[model samples]
Target: MTGTATLLHHDGTEEIPRFLGAPGAALFGCLHRPAGVARSLVVLCSSIGAEWKYNYRREVLLARRLAERGVAAVRFHYLGSGNSDDGSPDFAALVAQARQVEAWGRAESGATRVGYFGARFGALVAAAASADTDMPLTAWGAPGTGAGYFRELLRIERVGRLAEGSAAFAEAEEPRVRLARGEPADVVGYPLPPELYDSAQSLVFTELAGTAPRDVCLVEIGGDGSARRAAESLTERGLRVHASRLVEDRSWWLHDADWRPDETRQTVRNMIEETVDWFLTVLPT
Candidate 1:
């Protein structure tokens, strides 16, 4: 995990692709540094599974935009995903890794404040990690409860099982699969641990109250009553919450094959613009 950070030059920015601290399984990160002094440092955490893959371009675009606005950004693959080494994937550990990257961003860019922006599953991770700190947060399309999210995950896995056929069933006969209580051995192409699924099975949105940051801007890709209610609850819990229902209707995770890339790109731009506008209003200039 301890290797020299390679500085790669990009348009009007410096990109450093490095392996973060791991004894054997190093986490991969690509830090985007602004050409001038940065106003703040932000860490981008991606959702699990297909959302992460589909929305990667959007994340890169946002990082570039943030750099242009004097915000240093780092996009990292969480443990067991992307270029990162394979390790046990759990929600709690992902949160800790995000915090570690946040600290790294503060040190690398010499920024005073560190903020987090996470999408889907990463939104939960961002919320959990930044709760004790004074940092601002932007959470997009976060589930109101863990059970709901877990159900969706299982459904996805079932579809994958049907597609993969009898070979997948044979794999399911393994002893650990039976003991894991229906926790997926793998979701799509991602191998999931039983502990990760168990942790997610009990996730409730209200639990975020215990570990919320001072300010949060809750965003939903499509309007949902549950998301709005979660925002209201957060407000009552003493955290400043701004809830908005964004009109980006493309479901990056559940869309059909006929989905248009141009439409998705536009939706991503809309989300990014909304988030940047909110950050500009609250974050110190």
Candidate 2:
């Protein structure tokens, strides 16, 4: 066994499922190690709620593909999500978690470097993390700010509730929403505590004062060009940025039954290819 972790599985590659961070509140993580020497290790951050449910398959595929390319990868649950312990996942703790996981991946795999790849809300977390630490990063479908994300979550929740019935709101008590204050807000089946909201409201990427990672890539799923704008903004801040766009007809983050099997598979393939290719291109010769 590597370190004190248990070997969870061994199909084509070895998977280590373990807990990390301070005792009594450990975050669950699955580390995928290559059969040979790893080129690098990357932590894949996930979006929350329904997005998380739909994107799990894609993330798993990406991890396996990375392992096949001789790169170690980690897919972990944030403090309060998935298999992790119950606790409010705040921005500070998330940033710290990314940094710590990066360091741990480097140590565990003996890789020359460690990087990050985040999707949706996870992309924002990755960007904020880049401001705190220097590392190669890939942000896919990232928003401009945390407050915007908070609003999006609320919108999603409202739409979901409305689909049930018009009288739903009238009969049921709603979760009180507050910004910049520590309060419990349950949006779309996820319990978000006060610190998370307070920190999220202040996360404006363009307004951030810290420097981003030197190597960065921003990808947009469709033609909105938010990723392009973010790339340009980061370039203006003196950070090298690469941008790309992929065609997506609908929101893959949603749990809609409208997705065609072939189209969904192709979309996931495009994302994995673009992400892995960028990592390979940026590696030092």
Candidate 3:
């Protein structure tokens, strides 16, 4: 499996479609529905800004592997990302949307158990969504804190300014810069709407939704120890959660410039194997 093109398979052990899921919504996704009997169904959650441009290929391979292993999987784009609808839906709405997809998966696939596989912001969304649904499920690479990622994104944006060689802008005494009568400002791309931005700005880790004995496998893709911290917090709350680093995921697929955007590799398979063992064996159903 490679890209969405590769996702358009209908043969046994291949991804299929159920366009009947959400009628008015315009999300782009593929369902690797079961050919024979399925043991479980999984919905994959992606990052904010998606990272879908770079990570979609990897997800395709992962979804296919899950399907091949008898776990029917659904990989879809959230609102405002990919072929999804306009940039209007907020984070909570996105969670509901995922649940909507999950409902469809259950109705159509007849899965005995349902689960989630998330990456980055998707992890946070998955956690929130699972908390809302009364489903016994598993989470992978779940993010407990949402606003923390936004702060890091702001830092990345600042560094991006420096990379463009704008010393005056970079060395400015403060972050906020007012309009100068003799100077000017350029908005290269302000495509993002304020609704999403404000929502992301105020997000925090909390037990707002319902609780389940979740089996969480934290995939740390960054050097930061936030994954560990999140695991500790969840455990303290009495949730069955554990954090583990896919040590080379960041080195190979995360960094910019060197990312081989459209290749299927063993890294994804390795990740699935580790998480499956944790979710299927160690974590309670």
RMSD of each: 3.3, 3.0, 5.5
Error (Å) of candidate 1 at residue 152 is 1.3
The C-alpha TM-scores of every prediction are 0.85, 0.88, 0.78
- Candidate 3 lDDT over 1-285, as tens digits, reads 113443344557656554333445656667786567876788887765624455667677777767766677887877766666654666777788788778777776778677777776776677677774444344444445565665555565566576778775556432223222222222222233345545655555435222555556667765567667767776776666666766564443345555554444466667767766654563222
- Weakest 10 consecutive residues of candidate 1 by summed lDDT: 170-179
On residues 1-285, what C-alpha lDDT tens digit does candidate 2 reach at each position? 123455544545667777776665777778888888876888888887777777887888888778767788988888878877777868888877776676667777778877788888888677666565567888778878888887878877777788889898666455543433456766777677777777778787554422754778888878877887887888888777888888877776776567655335777788898788888776531
Runs off by more than 4 Å, candidate 3? 1-11, 18-24, 132-144, 167-190, 206-210, 249-255, 261-266, 282-285
Backbone clash total for model 3 is 0
For each candidate, the alpha-carbon lDDT, in order, equals: 0.74, 0.75, 0.60
lDDT of 1 by residue, 1-285 (tens): 354655655556677777888556678887888888776877898988777887777788787778777788888998878988887767788878888787777777777877788887887787777777778888888887766876777677676676789887566544235427755465656666776767777777557544644778888767666568888788777788888876644565655766776335666678788787777666654
Off by over 4 Å in 1: 1-11, 159-184, 209-213, 248-250, 262-264
In model 3, the worst 10-residue window by lDDT is: 178-187
- At residue 169, candidate 2 shows an lDDT of 62
Deviation from native of the Cα of residue 58 in model 2, angstroms: 1.1
Cα error of candidate 3 at position 220, Å: 1.4
